[model samples]
Target: MNRPTSLVSALSLALASNAHAATAADAGAGIHELQRVQVTATRSERAIADVPNTVDVIERERMDELLVRDLKDLFRYEPGIAVGSSFGRFGLGDIRVRGLGGNRVRIQTDGIPVSDAFSIGSFSNANRNFVDLDTLKRVEVVRGATSSLYGSDALGGTVSFITKDPADYLQEGKDAYFGFKLGYEGSWDGLFGGATAAFGGERWSGLVAIGHRQGQEIENQGEVGGVGSARTKPNPQDRDGRSVLSKLVFAASESRRFRLTVEGNEDNADTDLLTSQGLQALTGAFNDSVVAEDRQTRARVAFTHEMDAVDAGFADSLDWQVYRQDSETTQYTREIRSGLAPPTLRDMREREFNFDQRMYGVQANFRKGFVTGGVQHELAYGLDLARTETRQKRDGLRTFLVTGVSTPVMLPDVFPVRDFPISETTTAALYVQDEMSFVDGKLRLVPAIRVDHYKLEPDVDNIFAEDNPGVAVSDISETSVSPKLGAVWHFADDWSLFGGYSRGFRSPPYSDVNIGFTNVQFGYTAIANPELEPETSDGLEAGLRFSGDAVYASVSAYYNRYEDFIESMRFIGFNDDGLMVYQSQNIAEAKIHGVELKAGVDLGALSEKWRGWSLRGAAAWSRGEGKGPEEVEVAPDVFEEQIVTRNLDSVDPLTATLGVVYQRDAWGAELAGRFVQRKDRVSDPSYYRQGGYGVLDLYAHWEFAPGARFNVGLFNLADRKYSEAGDVPVVGGASATLDRYTSPGRNLSASLSVNW
Candidate 1:
């Protein structure tokens, strides 16, 4: 059936279910996820409806019910969120909120920031998907600029992953618990399994969890297969991953608690680059065999202490944590080339890359509540300090198959080059926030401010200086201040209005400020730019929320203005040596505005005739534009620079999702459809454009026996062929093999779990 027909049929089924006659007592009340508690927005526990900022919380129950196995699956139904992917080997990159992506979004696991993404050429990519979903108990997502609370790298949003604790498993009479889960997904022929064990005493508790997964290349809606860039079939790939999480907790007194946590995860992939073959026939060189092995690993150890009864009168509670994290990515590629022409010689080329980061940090916060005159106030203050060392190296070698000879093949430069000098980045921040309540808690005000300082120190080594002779790497030190104001007014029963203004900023990265690359053969060179300014954003938002017995809904609108946007490796002009010079600069100003809506209706609560029926939906629409310096050619080989305003292609088009859910005693099912509008607004007219499309998904859950449960999901029920706009390059024009980017067609996923 077509997409529209499928959706109509699903809606018809829902309407029919709603018309059924039943008693009111037989109906069940479902939990509203939008009202859940979250901590990312203010660094303190607060319900989503009470906070002035936009926050979304996904609990473990939601993950299990939806059969979520990866980042893409986790956000399958979210309207304004997306996951980025390229080709078939790079897999999933960072998560995108609204329009901005990549390094603009901040991601953390248990308060430790994830590794940054860095890419050079087409062979090396280090993404930010280091956490395993199985080990997480909940995930909190905060939208819009939030630097006042998170310091830096929170320009677009923040995602925090909270892991499971031992107390979650121990029951009233049980001191130990064990659980197991197994799952399979058809999209990649993936198989995964996990186990959890926990034990607790009166004063101490411990928990350990482990998970493993193996999968093949992700499937797409393509048929053609062979070699070269024209091939529509995905490349052959094999991937394996494992994760381990352990925690130990101790309770010293009634108001004091301590926790020690250790977590690690690693993923490895081997891919055969079938799409890279038969591209180079001019130089009598053809890629006969190309293979790449990519590996990513992350590990962290942390200790935390919390005290509620502080002796100091200024503070009522105190929390502190110290941690050390290490993350690394390594990629190795080996290629063989053969010639059918004159020389009939063969050669082997190999490339190796290693990117590593080690971080040590300490964080502390205090909370106090007091009354000043006739006003009530709750104050929160915190300090953060961290030092990170980053290093990267790229090396390669070539060997002649005919003779016993080996040499490096990097033309116009030497092998074993360092893109940037080894550097230590130190960051320190202090922040304070106060929540004031007036008129018997009907009106609330929140004011917050933060001060941050960062310094980048380059430690040049012989390997870096030897590659780029006479190049001087400069150091950078900068400080920024961010402030925010928010208000919430409860005008009527079960209804409230909220608004906020926030500021955000990101310091220039060490690699971008001191990057070095010289390619004499290509008549181009990329140099460092220590004079670049930091990127900053100012955002204003307002929303209305309603919560009632039979219905709940929320509508929000936001506008964000950004300045001094950093553009990396931007081509300026020809230098004195007739080489095109590329440097990083602050070259753009942009504005993004959007509206979001979420609504749900419980038919069971309204009347007995519609028992066990519920309806839920969400929608998002956004538009963005950027003003940047563009070169206009007035004469042959001559050009003039002009400031131009154009639509930003990073912004996703309008999207809406609707679902019908039904619940009974021991079984339930849900049907959902996601509708996306066509994308046409772009800076370049020739950029690739996609038409509107809709996809239907179905999920069912069953608890047949005590401590045993099962879940099944059928996605893309209509077998629709579509692609996420973010996954496809916008400036590449039209591609002949557009089907290569299409999402999976008709897939199934199922999981089974047991506990005792």
Candidate 2:
């Protein structure tokens, strides 16, 4: 188990650590005394100092005390982890650890898989996460694959959201409270509303909370055609948008609790990258619009019960979840792609799909006081089974008022601009895990295996249209098994070492193998290729952790061998026009390796002038390479030289964070600095490497009264000009419609919270 470091490493540390011990520890406690910290990523509530692996946690108070609004802000003190995409609004942030992102990483809410069977395709929206930030108590980020508590994507790593439970505010152990959030400024202008209430008696407890935010206009960093970077905003249409979220919970009995939640969010956004004639033309991300509207609704039921079972198990817990999403989208726009004809009105497309999923799991665990050859042994074993099914009511219509030289096709009901075929899919998996602790709980070993069976059935004739729209369809099925092994050794009371090896996979997308293009009247379509392989990876991870009340530090590194990657290629035919047709292909292998280190030391008071002073922070660096077609087609030619996620990400490979906060019983203020080098490295051949940048954020908080508090913060204080991620797309022909979505320039917001 990874535990916090002791007061000091050696006898010499006792004196050096004692100086700051009073500041890091509570005022009334011993210098090394530590507050209780509990973590549950292992499917059990245990001490953080006892878990031996690379992990990072951000509690609700810390995130709020710093006035943090974005997920990227947490990455400062954290290393080897990154949040993909900035638009989740707490409902959709993707995670990447050790440079393995997207489907490779698993996102969960209470141990349930977040993705569905249709989680595929470029720009695919996976994990319809409902755990909005307003309702979160904390998040546990397990780096690497030390423990596959869940299945599949866990091979890369696991990021799970643990919701806030009811808190007792009553002097008799019962409490109730409510609050609302509304904000307006240049950067993120929105109206947020929230309420929370909880009840706790000697033997019963309950909690409920809800939050929603509607926003408009995102801050601008720099516009391609703008005269200066000072005010880089686009036309009124570019920055207009809005979103919302809500949550609720109920509980009865000490070990049995249930939560019923009906929450959803909708966004009407401008696909601004599509341009008529602008600098974006140089990047090739055709600037064109057609507004996009996406919405999702989720209903979940979860119950946790602990029992001293007949099987001699000390504790057993069961969990079940039912998730649903009704997705509808429509696009309206016109574009003369070839410029050979008048701006012809693009075909109108619309898509609506319904997804309902259910997952039930039970774990029977035991921690018995047993003697193994005079040495104690504690073992936990459990079996897991989950099944998912999806049925959709789909309808799409696309017709050419007049066929142009080059015709463009879209997926079923693709909105006003394109049309595509519709299909249904179902998937299931089963798994088992065993963890044994011996030598008096000083050492632990866990082994897990999961088997999954996936199948997709689609009707070709109906999907392609009775008019013979050129589209191919097929039925397909596949199965796979993944194994994971891990061990943790508690070297001492305050230090531990751990390592693990695991395998994971990304099943081939049904659309790529089962769906094909159609020419309709042309009688030509890219034939469906049902023979496909899933993208897989085998990973190994190791790390050490040390903890104490005043000083806590950890370092971890991991390596992964990724094989059978799925990629799209130009294997299909091209029309007489310059346009080309592309099909999916199985591609080359890849590898990623990296090291991460983070430590915090409480810098105590230096003099009377520096009383109440404290300092803490961390730093990290990482890199990787592609070994297949990616290397040959992109990056440098050599396999070792090809930059992988370890390098191709938005920011630089080297990054770090530092912050200082001074707090008393009632007030606190802090200043934090972050540095992210520009990606001097690039996969594209066009632009020279980009320049790196650094930013400073400041936060302050004041207790207005016993139950009320006010917080104010300034972000991008230097008003730095930076891009969100690389605007350039590698691995293909150059095009001018590239997207240049940049970060906000400078903005300020004040949030006030009251607890009662």
Candidate 3:
């Protein structure tokens, strides 16, 4: 990683050269100011260049050109971000930013938070990849801590998805409109289509959209065919999904408006695992079959009033909203095995697991503008309240057949009935921020703060603790305060320098605090810890930005420190049944630092022949370390960690993306490449080292008519075979046979849409 001084110097020199050259060549072409990128995730609408933090916005046009089908595909070219799936698990994956992931990042849509983190057995629901991409109008990604505004789970960053409203579909000077789209993906042998209808009258407007897709299993490059020759290839499965979105808006007057939105999504898949070597080994059976289903539904209502129209003295506008979200995941599996003995005992096992989460919340915001001491100011204050409920259940049955005679048998549960009891959590928060400008708008400062309070109550009677009747489970409560300060100096007409300090914190989830389970056969038990504290962090960032007629660039560097980091810990003492005990505890302190660079150039300003040509690129590098105890097994079933060691779970390899685009008349095309550096820093036992590789992508779109268009995308153009550094390798095999999860090979997709 480059130091701050070197980075600044390099960017300054490039800006000088690019500005002069562009100005000299396009002297008669007139000045072309860069387009202002607007963002709303900051609690208020502001241009990205004016904000004191790193933010990226993906507009509707860019989204359509990329032919994105899912959240994973949407972030393929984004810097400082990586998306990948867990090994051997379908429909399970997460997004990592600045070397941090899981529950550390907050995901929201239209200012409403989604489902809570839920994990049980082989099924996990931490990732928020359930939303439909077609229903989104734009996406905003804020890098670094946003806890000062979003509360907990904003330690790493925030990703907000803005859904489309009826106004988005209603064309200018039009009262009614409709659109239809058809798409196909070659790799998955998939076909999908969608239709949208919207209409608006004098005071009422409504829009409805429906989309459906069905496909076979995803395709991979398969095994390397050397040491792991016996390992079976990826399993084949049948998959299908559907999503619906509808919104209604009422405009009583120019000063007030009301809106209501409803959305639903469902996905199902069935896997034939008879040829999966990893599954066979994990189940200790010859053949296995699995079926999975996931669903999400949400409804939201919002109202906005202009205080100026109402003659309010202290506020400019007021916005309030309430929402309800529900999510559920269910999995069923069956395993069969035959024993080589005299009676030839055939054992069959069947298991079913279900997990569900529901959330309801209401929030209101007030915006006001004022002036003091010859300085201009904008203030925003808000209050948030929400509650969440989580539930999980598991059941298993085993039967044996001897000499062609069926016999019932008693067997230990494959998955414990419950680790944590069903729980309900309530949260309330108050937040405020002020933007102040001085020195005739040349210098600006922003100060913000937020206070959050939460309570957790667990159902002790429903807990699944074995041989531990006296297990204690109590209610937990905590409060956190986060503060942030930022400043930006517009030193030059087209350039600026910005920096900020922000604080973040995350309270332990219900599963982590009230975690309790006992596995008699495995001789292991996990106990609840009510004394756990929240993980807190403080971060500082500095950056420079330049916007010219033909050039735009941004460079930033940040450092973050964390305390009371929560992680699972194992105790040396044994229970009455001689089972090892583990609990979640505050056990570590850590630090992370990273740098990001992004630049773009307009080729049309340099020459006439390349009038529609453009070049753009982004790069990021990050590293992190922590101090914690290293548990060492002194004797059988005994552990000790007298000496502290360095933790390396926060390090991520360098990543970069470069692209070229051309647009002329009604035709457009883009070619881009992504590169990942080799990762050899194996400081963590759970992470696997991976080699570096690069892949290219091609996209093109054409408007054959005024309201008709066609688009095509060819991803992984080189058919390069590789895996991300953070992907875990498949287990249940010898070390030599274990290999990093393989990514999808070359794939092609195309779509056509018509509007009227």
Q: Which candidate is the best by lDDT?
A: 1
**Candidate 3 regions off by >4 Å?**
1-36, 123-126, 224-232, 275-285, 288-310, 340-345, 401-416, 463-468, 633-650, 684-687, 729-740
Q: What lDDT, from 0 to 1, does candidate 2 have?
A: 0.50
**Candidate 3: lDDT of 388?**
87
Query: lDDT by residue for model 3 over 1-756, one digit each (tens)?
Result: 111121111111110101111111222221231233545545878777788888877766667777878765678777677665654435545566676666788878888876655555454344456778888888878888899999998888888888888889786679998999999987677888999999998889999999998887666666643221254345566778888888888888877778888888877777665343233554344443343444434434444333324446657887888888787766666656553244365656566666777888888888888899989988888999998888776666665645454432334454436657788999999999999999888898999999999899987643365433456666889999999998888899999998899999988788778777566777776788888899888999999989887778889999988777776534536878788887777776677798988877878877887787777778888877666555556777675564444434445578888877777677777788888898655444433567689989898888899889899999899899876654543232234433436667899999999999
A best-first ranking of the candidates according to their TM-score comes to: 1, 3, 2
- Model 1 per-residue lDDT tens digits across residues 705-736: 88788999999999999998767764345678
Score every model by TM-score: 0.95, 0.76, 0.89
The lDDT of each candidate is 0.83, 0.50, 0.70
Which candidate has the top score in TM-score?
A: 1
Q: What local lDDT does model 3 show for residue 33? A: 19
**Which portions of model 1 miss their true places by more than 4 Å?**
1-31, 281-284, 340-345, 574-578, 635-637, 731-733
Report the number of clashing residue pairs per model.
Answer: 0, 47, 0
How displaced is residue 601 in candidate 1, in Å? 1.1
Task: Report residue 551 deviation for candidate 2 (angstroms).
Answer: 1.7
Write one digit per residue (lDDT tens) for candidate 2, span 342-458: 435333333333333444434333333445574554444444455444332333344433553333234322322112234455556665555567777788776777666666676
